[model samples]
Every structure is written in structure tokens, then in C-alpha cells.
Target: MAARTQATRLPATDLVRMGAIEKLTTRQDFETWSFLVTSMLGQFDLEDLIDSTIPRPAEDHPHHDRWSRLSKKVRCWLTLQIDSSIVRELRDESSTGWSIAYADETYEVIRRIIVGHAHTKAKSTWKSAIFMKREDYGSVEQYVTAFRQHVKAANLLKTPISPFCASLLLLEQLEKELPGWTGSIEAGFRSDIAETMTENEFHEICCAAIDEGNNDNADRSKPTSDKPRSSDPNGNTSSNLSSSSNGQTHIQKHRMAPPKGKSARQYVAEWRAHEPQRTPEGNYNYNIVR
Candidate 1:
């Protein structure tokens, strides 16, 4: 007679017993939980598998039941993956209470824990996006692009920054670079511009202001007359000498200096300081006015 063949069964490996939970430590808790639930649904009931796989204490131990063992093992796994503070809070709360006997209840508790963590992380991201400021010397276009990226990463579309608020923030930084242009923009912001503008419109406005400022600076640096003036026949070596001298004298008397690399607010303050005295009724005195 031929020898009878015996069937051999292989014991489950550690990888099989742990399932995907072992690899989940590197992922966010919300993603891990989602992947775990989706991948394991057809194989076995998650709660039942967890209860059976986790080791129970000796019979003498007070909390030696399957539920207690499962809870302990779950906590241990979570501690390895998440922050110790979150684990400790979960432990104190006993999120999956002793009364939780069904798989649905276990899943609900776990879902809540993961969702809570996700919410906290999202909130921190939102705060960072809201407080974001433009880098020194950065362009308005660059700043807006960076802001959009941050808002998307933080999942802040539900509470996006208003165009007016974004414009105001951009103006704050632009004021330092384009004081005169920003002063005019500020006046518009206080009027109907704030309500009707979009982020793109604001960006365009900033770009225009920058261009205008550059042109103004270029014009100011150039000589008033490129061609040499013919020599004055009547002992007038310089043209408009009288007007120039009078203007210089007036500037000296009032201590008025041309604005150079100063913010609008600073320049305005200086100009106001040199102005004639005002009456008690807040009106300028014609006698003292320039």
C-alpha cells in the first residue's frame, strides 16, 4: 500500500497576526484607521480579531478578560504611533468603555479619537496660514501664490481669507516699499474698493502701484532738461535763479525736506509738523498758512 500523505499547516507569522497595523505607525492616525478598516473588512471583523490576537493576563488578574486585553493592546499600539499625551488622555477616558461589546461600538470610539486628532492638527495649520506674512522684499504675486498654497495645505477653503482682508495685509507690507502709491490705495480701500475687489484685482493693483512707483523714481532721477540751455545774454548764468533761490529759502525757513525712502505716514507726519498753526476750531489760520 502507498504511504498516506499527511497535510501540513503553517503557523501564522507575526506580519499576518499584526496585519497592516504594524506598517500604519508611519502614517497619520486618521489615514491609518481609514486604511485599516478598508483593507481588513473582507478578511475578518476588526474588533473580534483584535480581541482574539491580544494576550490576556493570568486568571488571577482583575482585568484579565478579552475586552480589557484588547483595550490594553490597542493603547499600546496607539502609544507607539501617536503622541504620549494623546495616549494618556485616551487611557484616562477609556474611550472604548467596558460596556463596548460590539465591533460597531469599538469602531465608533476609535473613529472619534482619530477625528479629534485630525481636527486639532487642521486647526493649528489654519492658524499658521492666517498669521502668514510676506517675506522681506518679496513681490505681491509671490506672496499671494504662497498664501494660496498654505491655505490649500491647511484645508482652509471653508473659511478662506476675504479679498479685502488679504488686500489690507498686502498693503501693510507694500506701504514700506511704495509709500506714496500705498497711501492712495489706502484711501480707495476705505471707500468702495474694499467691497468690490477680488484677490486677483488686488494683486493687479499692487503690480500697477509698483510699476508706477518705479516710473516716478526713474523720472525724478533724470535731469529736468537734457539739452544744454543757451548762455543767458543778460548776466543770467542760470535759468530761473530767482525762483530757485526763493524756493530754497522757503524750504530752509520751514525745515521741509523732500521725502526719500520714507513711509507715507512718516512723510506726512513731517509735513504736518512744518505746517502753520491751526485755530481752536480745527481750521487753519490764513495768516499763518503757507
Candidate 2:
């Protein structure tokens, strides 16, 4: 047999750099270019690289062509990463003589703009992801897993889901598939207390309920008795005897009544006689003080 060889993979930074170069050369749309460039720069830590490569000079020089050339190259790269409109604006704004200082400021401004835009887009995506409803036929686990993927993609790892919100969503999903199970789970979870639970805790609660429901269903589907039973002396079979006993117990429970107590009228009269009278000033007068 021939030995198999694994293909070599490129480093993440190299891949990002390649992508950035491709976008710079081919993508004409500003938004696409901006997004790709910003993502690549972040992945490769290009800002830090540029900063370290061009340190500030202690004294200002009348002729600093070397620093000016490096700054120009950096600016050119940034311009290529954006739209033509932005390029025109940058050229118009580049009235100041080029220097290392000017380059640093320009890079910082561009970085901030891209980072801000990225954050806004991310926030929107996260909001939409979390608010997504469960699909008609999708399982709770599948829906939750998809929501988690969305959270991860939106870079919301640190964002904590409110327990109240988590529980509400879980209950909504559960109610659809396991009607009365929600009530059983809710009986254990006091609204105020459950509201304090995290999303993970609520998810565990949902899983437990699902397992319990499955077990209950399995138990109900099981055969009650496989063996034949002997008839009683009265001609009742064992099954009939068991059913009668159950019916008698149920009857006794329904037939039971409340213990004898004072009559409602007498009780009300007694209560009235002992009740404190309210004065004109809204104070209770136990002794009926004038």
C-alpha cells in the first residue's frame, strides 16, 4: 500500500494577509473592502506591526524622506483597503506635510472607524441571534445549539443571558411539545428565584424535564400484567378485583366532606361583635372610644 501524505497548512496570519491582498486588488466596493481589510488587520495584528516599525523621532527634521516614504506606503495600503470616495477625501485632507506623526494619526483614525463599524454590526447580529424563535419542527436542543453558534459568531462569549429570559424561552419551547410539563417545572421554580438562574442552568432544567417526560411516557406504554390471574369466589377475575378496589378508593375520596363547624351566620355575627370600629380619623377603636 502507498503511504498517504498530509498537505501543509498555512498559518492564520499568512492566510489573512493573502485574503487582504486579494481584497485590496480585486474588491471595488468600499464596504466589502473595509470589512475584509479590517478583519485581516485584526487577525494579523497589523496595527502593532506598523506602530513598531515606525517609531516617533525625538527631533523634527526639515528633510525626512525615509520616514515620509514609509508613511506614504502605509497610507497607500489603507487607501487601497477603502472606497474611491474615501480615497478622494483622504487626498483632499492630506494637505499637511507627510511625517511619521501624521502616519500614526492617520492609522489610528482609520482603525477606530473600522472597529466602530464592526462593533455596531456585531451588536446587531447578536441581538437578532438571541431573539430568534424556535423553528416549527426543530428540537429544543437543536434550537439552543444554533443560538449558541450565533452567540459565538457574534463574539458574545462574555455576554450573559438573563435567567428570567432563559427560563421564559425554555418554557415557551417546552409548552409546545410537553404541554403540562411546564406547569410541573414551574411548580418547582418560584418565579422570583428562577429569574436568577443563568441560561446554562435553565437549559439543564429543560433537559431534565425532557428526560422525565420520556421516562413517564415509556412507563405508561409498558404492559401492566402479562400473566393470567385466578377468578375470585364471587366470580370476579383478579383484574376486576383490582379495578373495584381502585374505584372504591376513588369513591371514598369524593364522598368525604368537611368536618362540622360553626354556622356561617353565627360565625359572621361573632366576628362582627369582636371587630374593632374605625374612628372618623381612620384609627381603629378596639374599645369603641367616643
Candidate 3:
């Protein structure tokens, strides 16, 4: 990742359009700004922004009490970062005798905007940053340095973060906690949280299933000499049961049926002639012969 450039001064007109810049210089005039910032977070509407920030009596809503409490924290954080008085007013209003209608609305809106925008930006930034880090997986220091560079790069791009930083910090903490398990920094950052079973472990499960299947087949193949036969009306003769190599008890008297239709080799050849085999379900699919 490339180094991030310094922040530049944005035009006043653009700031005003985004509601980041306000004409209000006094405490009373800052109400409009509070409302606008709240709306961006999806907490309040344009009308509410003006009324609550201005402390206009008629414009207040009953529901804003809850919002007021929540919006204060976010507004304060935003204010500190933005260097705007209106932002400060919103932050200050968060709990200071503010109506619930104003607080809840502002809190929700600002939180939403921060969360939603930060997530969107973080996804793009993390992907690019992590990919580059992966390419230089041999050195952990280099990976972290690159990651930080990417973050600075993202900030330079005017991306919202306050929300994203925590997740990244947690990832950093994980590295600190397990310093010995180091390999690739990018791999650490980019790997999915859900741990997958190793291939050998998975194959053992399959092998166990196969063994069970063979055992079931052997049991089914056992001859049933105990079955009543017409030849022994009095049932004077009893069949001898012996264990077979397949772990199945079978009667010695049971005879094997002769191969039908064609010889084993010939039958196999004929079966192979059919390019694709049709399963019992009548679906044509490829199969491998052992």
C-alpha cells in the first residue's frame, strides 16, 4: 500500500451541502447542525434536526428522549474529529436536559451513518490491504506496517472508520496474544473465523463410514440356514453356523449361485461398453470401476 497524503481543506459550499459546515456560530444556532448529523446516522429527519437543535418547543417529539441519551456520545466523538462547533453542540446536547425525542433520534442516526459507512469502506480497504499483506507474508512487521499504511491510505480517501478501528484492533490483539503461532500476517488478518477440520481428520471420518458400510454389506450377505426348508419337514437336522472372514455368521450348507447371463469378465466388459451408467434412480452419471 502507498503512503497516505495529508488532509486537504474542503470547499465551504461542499461542506454546507453535506451539512458538515454550518453558518450557526452561537449555541442557539447549532440546532440545525445537530439535526443534520443525526439524520445522516438515520436517527432524525430534517425537520427534527432544526427543532431539537434550536430547542424549538413545538417541534419536539415524545420519542426523542431515548435518542438524546445515545446521540450525545457519538456526537461528541464526531465533534472532536470534525472541528466543527455544531458538531460540538450536538455532542453537548446529548444528555444535558435534552428531550428524549432529540436524543434517541440523533443517537440512532449518527450511529447508523457511522456503522454503515465505516463497514462499506472497511470492506474495500481490508480486502486490498490484506491481499497486499498476504503477498508479503514472510515478515510480520512488514505486514502490520503495510496494514497501518493501508488504514492511513483509507483515511486519506475520506472513508468513515471509528467503527472499523475496533475490529482491526481486536485482530491486532489476537496477534499479541499468540505471538508464537506466527507465519503470515496477511493470513492472520484474512483467514475466516470459522475453523475448518484438517483434511486428514475429514478423511478419517470418511474411512470410518466406509468401514461401517462394508460391515453392513457383509452382514446382509450372510446365508440364512436357520430358515425353514421343505426338505426337512420334521426339522430333525440343524445347520452349523460358522464365523466368516467378513465377521458374519453363515451356514456351511448354503450354496453359491452360478453367474447368470455371461461370465464375470465378459459381463464386466459389456457393462463398461455403456459410456455412462444409469443409477437405480434413472439418472445418467459417470462412475469409476474398481
Candidate 4:
């Protein structure tokens, strides 16, 4: 029994307190998490899995089983420390044809990720984004998501302000975007657990507002239909299509203007509304003066 116990026991150096690390929520959180996580891997004698000092063997190789096990252990330690949204972003990078080869990447893949983010720079840009709203992005959803990202980037910053101050800042930003929002919303945004940005609570709170904004946008874009029908100079009824060489109108497969109610004014409004370069601020942006 004593011999079996001795055989099963790991060396003192091989054991590490897993609780020593925290989840990596932002670039600010990366440095500390990376150092501690690397130390933990080293303590377990698995540093080689992430360091690129050793090459991996093919699956059929004799030593492949050991390498695969160690690589998985290292990968688990790395990923389990990241925020789930961040995890999804990392996994989604593969679709963008980035450096990572697969969504479920090995520790060496994690190592590459770390190498990309471990650069030493700090900026206050995220501070400005804390107040970010609809000035930039086209949709309410895009604007909302950008605001969430800015807050997330600010998450792990060492306090120039207290956590109490941080919550107040978040509240102020929320109030700017949503004038009447208060009570439980203020409470949730103020709470660290509720608006972590990785969590769905904040998003769920604003879903109604988002849908309403989009629906309002849709309604405004719809053309008015009560006008009397007017034929083109060529006597063609299809206003959305082009005049054929023989003075007949041909239906254009690619033209998107309304068949029934489109007028010159409506077409211009739609054009400016959909223009990517034009910065729109809701329905007010549709009107153009000569």
C-alpha cells in the first residue's frame, strides 16, 4: 500500500494551485494572466507545449500520445482562463484566414495568440469609447455592441478611479444612450456581475429598444404609395427599370427601387440613406436640399 501511494504521488514541483489565476477578460488582464499561467505550466513540467522549444510529433509516432496529452493539458489551462466571448473571438479568427488553423487550437496556437497580444502598450482610447454611441456605426446593434466592447477593454485597467467611480461612469454612458433607463437597469449596469460585457444581461436589457429602432428605420424607408400613377416620357409604367433601345421599358433584375411608388425624390432619399460613406442619424438624414 505504501509503495503504491509513492508511485501514484506527483513530485512537489509538479503540483500547482490552479486557483492562483483569474480569467483573462481584456488586454489589460493579459500580462498577469500570462505570467501566472506560464508559471503554472512550468510547475507541471509542461512548458515545452507552449514555448515552441520542442516540436510536436505526428499522431502515429511512438511519443505522440504523451505529447498530445501534455498539449491538451496546456491548451485547457490557457483557454479556461479566457472570457467566453474572447474565446469565441479567438476561435472565429480561423474563419478570417488568420494564423490559427482551427477553432479548437493547441497550446502552441494559444502561444501564438499570446504573442500577438503580449505587446506592451497602454491607451486611454477605451475611456472615450465608454461613452460611445450611434455616431459611428450604421445600426443600433452595431453601436450597442461597440459600446460593450469599449467597456470590456476598460475592464482590467488598474484604477485611476475606484470601482464605485467606474460604475458611475458606466451609468452616465448608459443614460446618454437611453434617456429614461433607470432603477433595475442602472442597478444592473452598476453591478460588476451584471454588465460584464461577456454576459447577456446588458444585451437582453436593450433588445426591445434595438428592435424598435430598427423597425422605425424600416418604416421611414418605405415609399409613400398614394400618388397618382404617372407614365414615363416613353409611356412605360415600370419606373424602376431602364428604357429599352426601342423606347420600351425592360424590367431590371438588379434594380431595387419600388415598382409602384418610386419617384425621383424617393429614389434620392433611398440612395443617401443606403450610402456607406454618408453618416446618417436616423430619419432626419433622408432629406436633401438643393
Candidate 5:
């Protein structure tokens, strides 16, 4: 047996223990539509193959026989990539919405790992002329002899990694370390982009909202205000969307004149009820409002 060295074997375990080995588990949990999976994964299983027998997408569509055009494996991989990237971006601390800081630090670590060394790896190796030392290997030598392969066999080194595979691995890395990070990440990611804007920008947003002639979204766009008090000189301001700083309504407030006739039971009830019916001890009990 070729003797294993401390340098190679130790780093391999560091990767495997980190759950990087699960990156290759591409067997999807759900059975996807045949034509779709083949178009995405570049390969397909027997079930997928059988389903594509029926013709799909009208012939006039640019990709009329898309099912036939793409291999099953390609289709599967593409789909996986989209899902995984979305998961990773949303789960990180810097993501918008739910501004509460994460209770765990894994997202911080993962973000650093991806944005720093991994991004520079290719250039770092190539600029140093390391590939010249391994000239017997193929042109894509950086991946052909990657460090993680000794611990786990992954096709990450393959040319044009299926977006799905890249996405899947990215998601898998986050999932392994962060555990419950997906829900928070997804919440942050899928939310409206406005969530990420600064407070001053949020003020400008309110001006934009008033310009839109809709207060329904004013809170999100404008500076938050303290709850208006009923007894204040403003005399019960209109809905924030319609209310002006002077407490005047942009639209006329139609005050109904007192009913011309009936000092009837309804009117009597309102007049008498103006002061809530109080208890024997003189405290108001809200149950009487009914």
C-alpha cells in the first residue's frame, strides 16, 4: 500500500467531519417531472426516461423538444443550483428582514470561507505556476487534483459544474453547519428587497410612498412615528396615509348631522352610553360596550 502521509490524511478528515462529504448525495428527495429533470440534471433515471415518452411543449416553442435536447443529469443539476444559492444567501447574518442577529456563528464562518480563499483559489494556484508542476494532468488541473477528493468523491472538479451541483453543495455546506439556518435564511432571502435599506433611505422611501398616493405601504417607506394620542390637539388624526402634518384630511371628512327626528332607543342608547356604564364602585366595565 502507498503509505498515507499526515499532510494528506489529516486535512481529508477535517473536510469529511465538516459534512462536506454529503455534497455528492444528489439523489433528490422528490420525484420531479421527467422532461424538467432531464433538462436540468443532464441525466435521468428509468422513471424519468419513461415519462418523457409523451410529447411536450408545442413544437413552435424555441425549445420545442427541450426534454429531448437536455440530458437528465443536466436538468437535475440546474434545478439544484438555483435552490441552493437562494438558501445560502437568505440564511446569512447580513441578509435583510428579521434583523435579529443569529444566535449561532456558523453563517459568519461559512460566508468568510466562500468570499475569501475559495474565490481566490484558482488565481492563487495558477499565478504561482503550480499547474506546471503537475503538467501530466489535464488543462483543468486545479480541480483534477483537488484537496477534498481524498475524503469524498465529488464531481465539483468537473468542467462547467452543473449549476444545480454547485447550488446543492453550497446549500449542503450551510445546512450541515447551521442546522436551523435554512428557515431564517429563506425568510431573509425571499422577502422584499426594501428590507435591506438604511434608516435614512427608509425616510426617502416614505416620501416616495406619499408620492405614490397610497398610504397602505407608508409604514414601510416612511419614518416611523409615535402612536398618535386621541386627546392631543390634533383631534384624532386621519389614517396615516391620508392625514397631513397639520392634522387636516386630504379628502373631506363627512360628518353626519345629528339625526333630524328620533330621540329613539338607539339615539338614547348612544347619548346615555357616552359615559360607559360604571360599576357600583364607579369603575368602567367594558363588557357593557356590547
Candidate 6:
């Protein structure tokens, strides 16, 4: 019989856009990411590095060197796809959070973020990733960096996204927010870039919303006395701990004043025709930072 021929092996760089996939930011995006990653690994026959079937060998074994090299490459590929915010938190858990011996370390930091008291802070980090944007940081590079720090801290703690925070839901908000924007003016962001607004412009949007809310309150002529005060016979009135003097909700106040541009009323109006995102339906203790 003639000698059997073997096919040549493929390197990672040959996968073309294998690295072009979006960074895994939220658990919402995770399902999609997982699908893509698994597909990519399988295509190149590299799934053994992470999949359950291939048990890791010890250092003394002959296959250990080759396994370690490929495993490390897989780990690099995995980490590179994660946001920086999540990476930082994972670093604390282990430099090789994605252990060459196994894959649990890889997801360990996606499990961190935010450092809000260690675990709580981990969540804060993830929130930052979900709400980060390209425009807010003045540059795409800066924005990506900030996004990663937040992602690193809040691993395994994906939360539901508010409708307002979804970039697609709020796309064209910036362009429509022109003092005289019409017929797609020169200064407005293109629709292609709007999808990223949720990650970046959400802070500014919240400020505009807050201003609008306050404006509505002003029109109603509602007294700032949103809560009752305790008075002593000595003629001193004590403020309630439940609310702020300016009536900030029991949750921490994160008021970010609108930037120098269109009126807050304008931004709010173009978005939802003057109806803003209302919240706090129950005992879910979540605080979104401005």
C-alpha cells in the first residue's frame, strides 16, 4: 500500500478575522460570544484546549510542553476577547486566571468587576463596561481602557440592561439633539456609530434626563419639601435621612450636569417624545452611576 499523507496544521494568525470578534462584555453578549468562540476553536481543531474532554497533563509528562504552549495560546485568545475592566479583577485572582491546566480561571474574572467592597465593586466594573461609550472618553482608546477596568471587577454578575441604556434604543439621539440639526448635518454622529452610544453617551444622557425631570417638577411648582422634617422644641428642624435636602432618592445621587450643547429639555424630548425611563419598581438595590 502507498504511504498515507497527513494534512498540515494551521496557526491562529491564519484564521483571518478570528481576532476580529467583539469583546465579551456582558452575559447578554456572552451567549453570542461563546458561540463564536466555540465555532472558531472547533474550526481550527483547537477545542481540546478548553473543552471538557481533554484533561490537562502534569509538568513532568512528555506532552505537557506542547499542551502548555497551546493552552497558553488559547488562554491568550480568550483573555484578548474579554474587556479590560474584567481582566483587572481576574488578575487579582491569579496571574494565570485562565489556568493552563484548566479553563475555569478564564471565566473567573468575568466573575469580578467593580470592586464595590470587593464583590460589589466587581459588579460596578461590569456596569461600566455595559454603559461605556466611544465618545465620552474623548477617544476610542481611552474608552476601551475604562470599559475593561469595570468589566474585570464584576465577573459572573451580569444584570439586566435598562431600555434607555441600550444604544440601539437611543441611537440618533445625539444627532437629533442639535440646536439646528436637520437633513443629517455635519457635526452629528453617523447612525453606524450610534450602537456604541450605550457604552459611552449614557452618562450625558442621564444628566439631560435629570435636568428634564427637574424642569417638569419646576413647571408643576412642586415644593422641594418631598419629605417631612422632625422638629425639636428648641426650634431646630432635622432633615430626614431617607432623602436629601434637594430630594435625592434614598439611593446615592449621581447627578451629572448636561454638557455644553443643546438644552437638556431638547435631548430628553427627541428621546421618547418627552417620556423618560422610569424605574424603582421594587426591592432591587441597584444604583446606576452618572
Candidate 2: clashing pairs of residues: none
> Model 5, range 1-290, lDDT digits (tens) per residue?
53322111111111111101122112231123223433432222212322223333344544324433332323233324333653454355346442312111222222222333253543553333222222333322232224122111122111222323332333343343234443443454334443453434333322432343233335358887775422212334333236678987675343322354745576657756787555444544332110
TM-score of each: 0.30, 0.31, 0.21, 0.31, 0.16, 0.31
Candidate No. with top lDDT: 4
lDDT to native, each model: 0.49, 0.49, 0.41, 0.51, 0.32, 0.49
Please give, for residues 1-290, the per-residue lDDT of candidate 3 as tens digits: 42211111111121122234444344233346455554654332222332233442222444343334334443443444343544555556556754324333544434333333356666786556544533344333444445555644454335633323423442443354333332243255434423443434323323433354355557679997654322222334434556889999976664322244557686567657867545454644332211
- A best-first ranking of the candidates according to their lDDT comes to 4, 2, 1, 6, 3, 5
For model 1, the stretches where C-alpha displacement exceeds 4 angstroms are 1-125, 135-141, 148-157, 190-200, 206-290
Name the TM-score of candidate 6.
Answer: 0.31
Measured with C-alpha atoms, the lDDT of residue 197 in candidate 6 is 43
lDDT of 3 at 243: 84
Candidate 2 global CA lDDT score: 0.49
Q: In candidate 1, which residue pairs get closer than 3 Å at backbone N, Cα or C atoms, i.e. clash?
A: none
Model 3 TM-score, all chains together: 0.21
Span of ten consecutive residues with least summed lDDT in model 4:
2-11
Superposed by TM-score, candidate 6 places the C-alpha of residue 261 at a distance from the truth, in angstroms, of: 90
What range of 10 consecutive residues in model 5 has the weakest lDDT sum?
Answer: 12-21
* Candidate 6 lDDT tens digits, 1-290: 42211111323443334454688776557657766877877776665555543445555665555555665667777778877866665676576443433343453344333222354555566566666654676433344345444443343344435323343322333333322322233245556544444534554543443454345446569655555543433445544345668877564433434345857676555654633443233222222223
lDDT per residue, candidate 1, 64-177, as tens digits? 354344444444443454455545554654654632343334433444454433566777766766777767325555655565555544543234566676667656766765
lDDT of 4 at 122: 21
Candidate 4 ranges with C-alpha deviation above 4 Å: 1-122, 156-198, 225-290
